[model samples]
Target: MNGPEEGRIRLTVLGGYLGSGKTTWLRHQLHEGQFARARVIVNEAAETPVDHALLGQASGLCVLAGGCVCCVAKAELISVLRKLCDERTRADAAGQRLDHIVLETSGLADPGPIVAAIKSDPVLVYHIVVSEIIVAADARHAMSQLRSEPLGRRQIEIADRIIVTKVDEAEPAELTKLLSTLVSINPAARISGAVKGVETALPSFEGVAPDALPDLNGQALKPPVAPTRLQLDDSIDWTAFTIWLSALLHARGDDIVRVKGVVRTPAGRLLLQTVRKVVQTPEILPEQDGLGEDNMIVLIGRGFTQSQLARSLRYFAGKR
Candidate 1:
């Protein structure tokens, strides 16, 4: 009644480089019957979470925001997973059932941590499984982005299935060249092609059957690796953080593909998530307990200095 009573959940991960159209493909899958009772995690390492806003309206989808479901937000992700599991158990008590979990990583996110998260969280390990890693690539930019951007390339290399987006816009020769290049980089992935408004290439989550995940026997879970935590004070000056972020973005615009975070501003706490060269306006979320304890932000890109980023935000600590 509440969650899935007795059914198979196809857990899928959709990943791609910036502007590679991962969101477009995910939107298509969410609406199709091929998917049922889906949970999504949109990871953006910036002030605003654009994807969260994009997916918020999906009727059957439940989303967890304010952190990527990877290293940075691993704790939060665990918390979310535990809560969902508890919900399932409660539903089971009431003779109800829930469906599946689908995670969509930000373009700049590393799928490794996400994989690691699913494997490591004991409570989640019992309820979820790593069904597939679907990586998306821009047909026009795959070669250069894969060769030059480690983050982008890692997304492609780790995929069980790869989807090449923007094929319709590319010249026929260009699409062929892109596919060839991607193969050279990651020969293990199963590659498919798609363009705008195309759903032919993306896989349906429904295909992930209950018996599919043999690895999740709910026996043992590995201990989690330690994670670094960043917390900001209630008096943080988000204006300063914004100014500093702008300057940092200007300096590393090429490397900084996205920035998203929840910060305390003079007016109130707001959520920010962005794409490269596109900073979304802050959105106010319902006030909750401990919202300010871990004032989190993510800086996703190459050549980024975490210390420098932390240093810049230290100004928001109200001590400078």
Candidate 2:
């Protein structure tokens, strides 16, 4: 393979389905200094961004929320890339030069469109070279997602690297099935595994049976999944809040694909998230004074409304 041109900047597109652990994997890589001197750009579907808070290790970071870069936000992405290129051109110090750009796409985005946009854009085409597309696929839910979601299938089909995340929690047989399916769909793509963002070995699926993926007519999708932001205030009682969340997940977990929140409490800042019905243990984040986005929750799913969620939370907390 030929090396990149002298002044061109390499951009890596990290993508995956909802709750597929894209941030987790990217965080680990940044911590390990894999992408040295790289600038990170995060595109989130929710207006109130949460995932970007965890990626402080990047050399630089920019967040674009409330739009999917593949469709709704392509122009914004191009503009950002052009700005980065201009900055690189203007930098004189050796340490100030950016080695690469890591764009973390919204979970709902289609990598194909994003990739196409960069290569086809008149200005971006001259300044940037797309390095690769790294996609993270959830092991526990890959089967169902691939079978039904056209967007999910497109993400996998175009990835250069497919990371099967949450491997430790997935069933062995099902994991094998997912591996087989991924290989069947994208034979040229390299496959690997990760547990809670740490790299691991993928078991051999030499003869495992791949699930028969149904032919989704592209329009047969369920209602589009969107992010609903909810506010958490000091007036809310803790016990009632727990009950409300438990009840909400219990009733609508299938419809609610991902839940992520960063809230401030007497103890410290807590990062809480869940994928489907599985609730992950909360982790404490470093204290930051006057974090504006604190006490906010973003639920990404279909079959729900913003007012309905806010009302339910308020009712359970006895604040309404």
Candidate 3:
């Protein structure tokens, strides 16, 4: 979405539910130079943000956190966009002028409202054009979620393109059911598969029947998800921590939706993450000095408190 000469910055909005791999997909796209010279904005619902650490190579990067951009943080997003437009307008003609922005929204966001906000803003309507709304769907968990999570269904319906992520990890039957369900939810949106954020061909399941999802009410009906942060020291045992995580997920996978953070060890900085009960492979990040959020993990789920998380993790780390 680049109308460079007209000074209107084209915007692409990327959204997905908790742990849907939007960050992974966006990181791969950035590494592949898919959006050259485009500014990247990451919206983190949690106060302690780590997603921004993965996308370091963007032309410009900013993190918006502490609220969901589609709801509580809508005004903040608009203000940032306006600031970008002002900078671009005043930029010297001899300097490089970026004309595109990719906004990676929080997992809990609804794209329809965000889109409406952008279109209705008098100033933004002229300064920015929303080129696409791309949503990433988790192949393993979407079938069950679309049936229960109203936000998930709305995301699918509002998307211009749907990227079914973790295709290789999910069973073929489950992937098929998810794909068919996505079609039933938003046949107007183009759908494709991605394994580890790399685009891949989807297998044909022509006769497969989509899941019969119920009519979910608004987001208020579901239990609220809040982030709980756990601080770990560098000397903490990674092995013990993993064991603790496995136990926690086994007991509360339904409630523990996401776990993500950067940790330090004998090796380089490691990025740890999990979606539900599925633990993603840890990634080694390029060392950055004075990173405050390191040695901390943020768990997003319901029915848990920060003190419980702290006590559990501390005990597991042998800090009796």
Candidate 4:
């Protein structure tokens, strides 16, 4: 559907491995009324959505049962998103406006395809923009899970932010190792700890910038070491950047877990992010001097060398 609407609905995809406390974190958010004006889409693998039931008294909550939204129920997800947007639009005319959308993917679900579906769909593209991918990692089991399950690693790799759940139950050293492993897998992501009954703010990516994209060259490879960050000296050609990024992600999405940055384009400052192969359409930011002029791009991945990544990004640099 085409529209002249001014505001796009912001979306956050919550995902993680099974038993990672995704539902527990979500329940906390709901009880705190953080999603008071948000339409929540709950995807469950079973015939009935237990998560939806647990979220009692939550307005605008909808369920897509019997399958994962990232795969089997993607079409239903699209339909539900459109319906939510339409309903909110009508509701706004009557005085209540929905502020955002929170999609709770089944714990075992891969969020890449769900993100792709939102960006590629003709109708949803005009209405929704994914803000971030948040994954809940169990502090006690994450390391073991990562060793055995490729899915577990992928979830960590794609996250923009990770909430380390069950922190209170984990031993100090185990928590340290888990956090370190998380950094090794996806250094671009911000890691936070969560415990039941202790309130932790629902992680948001708004106005957050990479702390230090560390250069890994000649350094002893270690867990929790920072990933390399590349800053272009000049504003990039948006078309050129898009072309390069699309090709890069298509070719190495599995290895290159998370990519996010702000860039200055002829049109404006744009926020760009991707999780694995699912690239979000760039969102325009307010025009301001020195905004994204640094052309900072942070890349987090495994197995690839720094020189290789540097070589790939070199073309995007403006002529000196």
Candidate 5:
């Protein structure tokens, strides 16, 4: 977008294992305008999603979010970038410019495929460039999760910058142990701690060796794992889906992890959020004129699918 300064598009790729607070950090970053004027791509693994609703004003900022950007949504990722570039060109024709691009990958996702897609994709090179990978870790649970999850290790492996969140929840001893563990996982990345909400500081990607570890062994880091993606383009019956979803939540709220998305309602475009059974109707933004997409919901869990819950949302498109 902004052509005069560098003719380069700085990209910040955010990644962290599930529940590591990636969304919270992104919400802050986007609001701060740190990555201003950038096209954002948010990826989620589940059919019932979480962060989208909490993203506040930035919900309209996202270009794609269904599954991991590197896996199932790779094509859409490229399409969004191309669209961003085209928009920038139009702006240039009209005497304006844009800034960089930011990508927020699912917590459970491995940054490998997404990185490869951006670096190797021919068209992307014409417009954007990968700036850095920012990995967030929950200080309270990071050590154990790093040891137990392959996705966790992969996130650390690809990090150019590592940030520790939820420091207030961790004791001094636990924080010390976490820093020690992080050194072994990624010594090159600068480590910083965050508490509650306000940890706003200039991002640092310095001291990260380009070839920090050749042949990064994610497999040796943890047990076997599998990745997934789903795409649906069918129309959704909002009335039926909403009624069914509410009933299902009342019955098995404990089974839900996180549910979030922009839903089409008779009133207007409504933002929905569900943390287990507790559902809150978030503030609705002005109608996005001419934007046409399904009443989409992305839910993520240990064993969730379009078949079981998709029917509940069957009035909507069948799990896209």
Candidate 6:
């Protein structure tokens, strides 16, 4: 599974609970040309792999059948990804470089372990970088599923972006409640509605800095923590900000769900995001009209306190 790789491949993992329309959202993306230059891996517990069949004649489509790719078939998943990387490298000479790789997990899968595997794997980490974890939630049944299934809630908790599917069928009140619940569970995730199809632009890693990716193999790690969110109100010092975040992830990488926000730094305004333990390169954004200079960051993770975050951030602010 080795080849003459040209550059890193962006990987997007799509996950959700059973009957949450993960397949439907993927179908839309394929038809809409959103994944035009991407290789897709579909995981299904059943032997037949119905979703693969529905996505007929699409190039670079593969399926991992008989088990969830996150657990029972994790090794197989890695093999498939490596194979794609090799193929991409071979095709590079022909000017057919792979732009991205999208993995659609079974509705029952937990994306956390799948993500951890990618970040932990030495070989895969070199060629692949996770762009985002997009979770599809059924708007009509989301509340019920959230209450009954731990996986359902966990999916929302770790998502970078959440697409609420089947919105056209859900009542206004039901949709409102579902949106409220989702916000409470993961304040850092960007939530969007998908009715007939997703019209909104799906999140991507488009201008991320190259140095944002952490060195997973070299970092000293710790136990996973409980989920918590921290919102900061003041500007941050560029040097102190990097030092604090690097140290935090170095020690508690496993506990972090995601850290995302826009902050005013000495360099400029930048958009920041981290999935699992790996951070995407921060993208510099243009200043918006009528918004005064302000720095705000929302940290969502497991097992940290608001006071603890506030105190640490205050120390950094004082340095600024």
Output the number of the lDDT-best candidate: 2
For model 6, name the residue pairs that clash.
209-281, 225-302, 226-302, 226-303, 227-302
Give candidates' CA RMSD values in order: 10.4, 1.8, 2.4, 19.7, 8.1, 21.7
* Per-model TM against the reference: 0.61, 0.95, 0.93, 0.60, 0.66, 0.60
Q: Would you list the C-alpha lDDT of every candidate in the order shown?
A: 0.62, 0.88, 0.87, 0.70, 0.64, 0.71
Q: What is the per-residue lDDT of model 3 for residues 182-249, given as tens digits with 9 covering 90 to 100?
A: 89888999999888789999989799998888766543466788777888877889889888999999
Candidate 5 off by > 4 Å: 1-5, 200-299, 303-320
lDDT tens digits, residue span 1-320, model 2 = 25555567889999999999999999999998888689999999888888887898988889988899998888888989999988887784655776699999999999998888988988888788888899999999878889878889999999999999999988999999999999999999999999978999989999897888877995555898888888887666777888998899999998999999887766678888988888888889887633338888999999999899989988998778
- Candidate 3 lowest-lDDT run of ten: 1-10
After best superposition, candidate 5 residue 48: deviation in angstroms?
Answer: 4.1
Query: Which runs in model 2 stand beyond 4 Å of their true positions?
Result: 1-6, 92-95, 289-292
Of the candidates shown, which would achieve the greatest TM-score relative to the real structure?
2
lDDT of 1 by residue, 46-116 (tens): 43344554454354444444445566677776776677677777888677655667777756567888878
Better of 1 and 4 by lDDT: 4
Clashing residue pairs in candidate 2, if any? none
lDDT of 6 by residue, 175-211 (tens): 7767777777788999887864575432332332222
lDDT of 4 by residue, 277-297 (tens): 667566676544331223666
* Model 1 weakest lDDT span, ten residues long: 207-216
* True-structure lDDT of candidate 6: 0.71
lDDT for residue 32 in candidate 1, whole number 0-100? 60
* lDDT of candidate model 2 versus the reference: 0.88
The CA-based lDDT of model 3 is what? 0.87
| Positional deviation of residue 257's Cα in model 6 after best superposition, in angstroms | 27
